[model samples]
Target: MNGQKLLIVEDDLGLQRQLRWAYDGYDVVGAHDRASAIDAVRAEEPAVVTLDLGLPPDPDGTSEGFATLAQILQLKPDTKVIVASGHGARESALNAIGAGAWDFYAKPIDIDALGLIVSRAFHVHALEAENRRLATPATTAFAGLITAAPEMLKVTRMIERVAAADVSVMLLGASGTGKEVLARGLHEASGRKGAFVAINCAAIPETLLESELFGHEKGAFTGAVKTIEGKIEQADGGTLFLDEIGDVPLSLQVKLLRFLQERVIERIGGRRAIAIDTRIVCATHRDIDAMVAAQSFREDLYYRLAEIVVRIPGLAERPGDAALLARHFLHRHAKAMGRPVTGLSADALAVIDGWGWAGNVRELENRMKRAVIMADGKLVTAADLDLESGGAPEPINLKAVREIADRKAIRHALARAEGNISNTAKLLGISRPTLYDLLKSYDLHA
Candidate 1:
């Protein structure tokens, strides 16, 4: 057994026995009616279910099948129920999907084709379960950010820890390293009532940057026709994310420092001192310390904003994250675009693992989007991602080859085990101590 439960809900005894025999690896259990299916669900709690829309007492109709689907989902919402029906196949598929079935198969069962769907359903279910595990309360503390790498998880935990405290946080990382995403995650974790507002200092001109951050009164400038709240005011009782804070001009840094010190702001061409309550969270790709030394950025302002400095690792530094993020992006885009792209090809996974993601998660996401649009097959290939599929060259060095093989095997085991050390060790046929030694020696993390 693969140690994964699979529920086969078919009314025909012969078909149920055939299905049970076909799936050799899974712990296959059968049910011929709604009551037995519900009982099996309660007992087995299978991750994936091959549900038939022709249960006993209503074998010719889908009423009992749909009811069983609804009850199964209500009991275990994460269960992947792949409904099968021959009656009005097309319409049944659509209705089953609308009724919360994970996927649908037409009866006249081509076991091979249905097996592929069942496997894909299991893969998707595992991916979703891993995502939920990654976003647990002790980890992410927010949605939209998905990562299983320990390095990134550490960063999220730190953000979650500091969210409730009223302090300035400065995220230092390279461009496209998801600094803004972390900032937003922090805001959400903070439980602030006001909106989370953000501004990219590097994207705005220095002339308009001040007005953008501090707001402007009517006729404050040539184009200022009405009074408006700035990002800080809009973020009152919440968090303000200033992306690329090193890009803030030296002149404006003085005014920003005043706001940090006094918790007050003066809008452009306005005299009233507006008291504001907002948490400051800023990020920058530039070396603010070097800028301070060069007199381009204020040293005082740097101190004010650097109350809690977090250094986020680049994508390359986080092992397995590139492939994980690629899978996440592929699923997101494929579903939104209504594409049938199931997963990434083996060569695509190789490229994702080997490539140094210089543009980080943003580049991975863009590539997945293009691949989803351009892919001709169910699996997204390296070519679909516009990436080189040429496998890494063979090594003449025996030691190098062994190390490479070990790394690849360890990564594969970790992924298969979903980052469970004991399971990974078991998969690799190694003792926990040996696996730990290998992980430390290879600088690998799960």
Candidate 2:
């Protein structure tokens, strides 16, 4: 295990010395009061913290201690906070847990037991942090495509397979679903010698669109003094990605179809047919079949371009993928910005899983980037991602209410058995069949 930094937030100097000595394995930092504790948290940014509820200015009450806890969480939400209260152990522990503390301990501090709890908290914190890192979207092969859904996986596999071939490839997906990244990946995989050129058919005007694709000869027209090579010629021996190909004008479509069929291009105002070697990849979020039906797009050109078609799945279709992508983006942006972001909280992960990401992977990436930059604490919370905190705690219907109870029971049993359902049921004084039923009801596997 990696040696982690630990902060002890006790006002008693003697107890601080004892705790620090006991946790010799940890890089222990001590803070006797609220000001010092907050300072320690900011400066050290420790992964796990031990907080004493009896603090200065309100040493007998939990007011100051709870305030410190709230501040620490607000600043660095990822830190594992373990609260210690001498006066009212049960109340303090429960209150702390409700307020988002990781775990709590009663005091006349059992040094060994507290040490074990602290160690366990640290282990859990580290594991969660690692999970978040692994789940982060930026770590995946594709830059912004976030999905673990089998349908999306099939599309990715298709892209991978077709990328090795020299055939014309087309991508179909909804807007903001990251077709361009897939296009770029195809270019990278093709082993092309020249640059991967890109042009958006819908973004550029029709007047300049022709000039954008096919080069103009010197004095080809007014303001064409110098010879200029279009995107196709520039991408010779490489890939030319045409985005929003459905919007290409009829005139340009004929020219493009001719080039695809003959492998030759006639630059504007030039007589010679220039033999060019360039791969073509096109993408459109629109339904090409409908466009072809409407006679807005050339059917012949569509058939020629879409020799291999890949369809990308939207974000909501992928189960567990949004959380994975969120974590990935957080790690990347945090590292790039030099922030001490540990990972997303459990609630945050749940929110990510539940959200309907209509804007797809692009939206998820943007949210994570912003959350990582703005996060004051080590862990990103649901609130940081603009998700509801604790995520609809109360179930409205009987079915949902039962499901919630079942989920809670299964989670508790799993925890008690250290994630072994068989052992957990035995501990819960329940049969394996009953446990399995509970698991199924809650949509929980383990």
- Pick out the ten consecutive residues of candidate 1 with the lowest summed lDDT: 133-142
Inter-residue clash pairs, candidate 1:
none
| RMSD of every prediction | 19.6, 24.0
| lDDT tens digits, residue span 1-446, model 2 | 24699999999899999999999899999999999998888777788999998899888888888999998897778889999967556787789989989998887889889989998988898788766544433123543555544456667767878887989999998876778888988888778888899999999999999988998899999999988899999999999999999999998999999999999998888898998999999999899999999999999999999999888778765555676677678889999999999788766766776678878888888989988977889999888899653223333345656665555545444533434678878856789999888765444545
Cα error, candidate 2, residue 287 (Å):
1.1
Tell me the tens digit of each residue's lDDT in model 1 across 340-364. Answer: 9988887787787778878888888
The C-alpha local distance difference test score for the whole of candidate 1 amounts to 0.85
Each candidate: what lDDT?
A: 0.85, 0.81
